[model samples]
Target: MSGAGNGFPVPDERQLDLERLDLERLARLRAQLVAHDCAAGLFYDPTNIRYATGTSNMQVYGLHNPCRYVFVPAEGPTVLFDFAGCAHLSAGRSAVGEVRPAVSWYHFIVGERVAEKAALWAEEIAELMARHGGGERRLAVDRLDPAGLRALEARGIAVADGQEVANQARKIKTPQEVLAVRAAVDGCETAIGRMAAALAPGITEQALWSHLHQANIELGGEWIETRLLTSGPRTNPWYQECSGRVIEAGDIVAFDTDLIGLHGYSADLSRTWVAGERPAGDAQRRLYAAAFEQVTRNIPLFRPGVSFGEIAARAQRPPERYRGLPGAALAHGIGLCNEYPLIVDPSAWEAGGVEGRVEAGMVFCVEAFAGEPGGREGVKLEQQILVTETGPELLSARLDETLL
Candidate 1:
């Protein structure tokens, strides 16, 4: 856990201050709720729940099931509605005041009784709101089904967009949160190094990608959010997941590690490498140089006070042949997941762009991809960056020197 075989240091979990991290996150959420003039906030997204409570249970499972949630009053202690018999998961967390069995009304769980179950769920939540809302009925909900929404509305409760509140609250990271991000990136870079070392001819792309998964888990990281490892012909088009095709010598292998690492923080970094220690082809070199240049140039534009549109306007773009290729952005915000503040390609700015200023404590993923219109291979390069008061700090600095 301390260091990988490739000599990259893996952070020790004991060094993180979990309590301060948890409390600060909760405080941020509460402040956002108060600013939005909401009496309480209801969270169904596992990422939002984790941000507000610092506890998790069946994170992936909870995402699709919608059987777990948490309630946070603007000024009171938070309560977690956990999965059946799973209340014990938050036993030692000070941010969570109470744990109760959740009411699950999803069709898969309730069948013909969805409405009944939803009504029951609404009654409990309404009772809590009455007691803790200080006579206010405004409830911000991250996500809910139509039935659940109707059930709450029938009781005269006003529903607001809780996802926006959560995102704005999470936009700025505390100092403790930054430390957590650094640790996740350390573990992720170590895993990436391991994956690169295992690259060889005759290995299937899937087989090679598994090294990253294994190393991440062995280092106490959670799940990977994507399977974007491809080689040679599969590398073009860029969104192809890892397959069983055997990689031959000199094939360009490209991958994006959309890894959710330690403490549920993401370490999203991408790289391309040539197999078997062979020199890259002329086309490969050109593609890689373009991607490398784009990432390096865009990263420095993430200084504090810079607007997202400004960054997009000033970003380095790929060549004309590589323009409009799918599956990557100029830059994006990264946290427990790919959160907010996406800086898109300038060409698409008029339609898909958003307005926001880059601020200190915000982390971003700067990305670039270079693949010719009819080429058989491509290069994808990305770097994780932390925006500080002075400038941008590169979090994942492990680049493939040979490929570059």
Candidate 2:
């Protein structure tokens, strides 16, 4: 367990703050991009940029200064959209010289000094990239935004999507990546405990969620959206909750959330419980039992080399059908975003889903849902998992078989 005996290094408390990111791994990534025809990767995705450069502090103020960008030109140095009050990024810098610092190639069309500066800055950045041996080759953008993308095309510049290049790189997580996921799971368990203690029959669903939000922030949750606490009949496929709805004695309180740790690792999980003391009501009991069955009995099919299509085939609705959400797949992969390439649904594979084999260090969440369609109750449960040579390791260990 110490050093790399387990083939993974566990960092101490101070080290867990994201001090040791793998720069060599990043070098290989850059080499891969260079090998490909990609030049000037315009990074718009926050997590994508963070994974490559090891800094999301610039995006902490996403709403106002939402126009942060990072560019690693094929033959040129790396560049970013420089901002005020961003000294924290340099102080907490991860891979020091790996990311060559340059400023603002793309500009935001909105906000103060945004539109005016964006055009000028974009021109300046383009010139810098060209001067640094960047040929007139096509540049890649992540999303298919026709405006910015087309505008560049109008200027006779070839544009590529950054996502196309990134997807293949992030699929297979390294050993260090697995450790970060485990740390995120630990933080999520603590947050869940605080939320559960705050739940009560008379308390509103919103109030329960408020407790979770406050606890997560207090405990250093980097960015958690939708601390979804769906209850009673509101628990179909909707992934949000309102505190206005009071928890009835027999209601099924489903706790679901998507979270990011301080280290930029993500873990999305859901746990449903029937609120009662010694005697859990009939509908509530059924929901809990079904949810338990999914997480305990059915969820373990997510092993290395196992195809998602194969897992979906196991969930056929019949005599041996798995019970959870009516049309929900078993789960999905949790990374920079709550949702990404890998999904637990069997049909997802039918759609040409992820084909990369799950390696020893891949981190994912095994989401399990149980509820009768058109029925008045529902249940959903999820846990963070890190795949290893031995098997799947549970990251969130606070999860209990039954409600507290």
TM-score of structure candidate 1: 0.98
**In model 1, which runs have C-alpha deviations exceeding 4 angstroms?**
4-8
Give the candidate number with the greatest lDDT: 1
Model 1, residue pairs in steric clash: none
lDDT at residue 276 of model 2 (Cα atoms): 49
Model 2 worst lDDT window (10 residues): 316-325
- Which candidate has the top score in TM-score? 1
For each candidate in the order shown, give its overall lDDT on alpha carbons: 0.90, 0.61
**Cα TM-score per model:** 0.98, 0.81
lDDT of 2 by residue, 1-404 (tens): 12424233332334343544545335644665775577666766777677666666645555344456666666545565545556456554554333333333234544355444445545654665576535655666664344455445544567766775766556556656666666666666666766777777888888887766675565566776665778888876545456588887767788777877646777688877665453566766665666666566544665778766666666433122333334445666666665444564554566655554555656667766666656676677777776777767777764565542
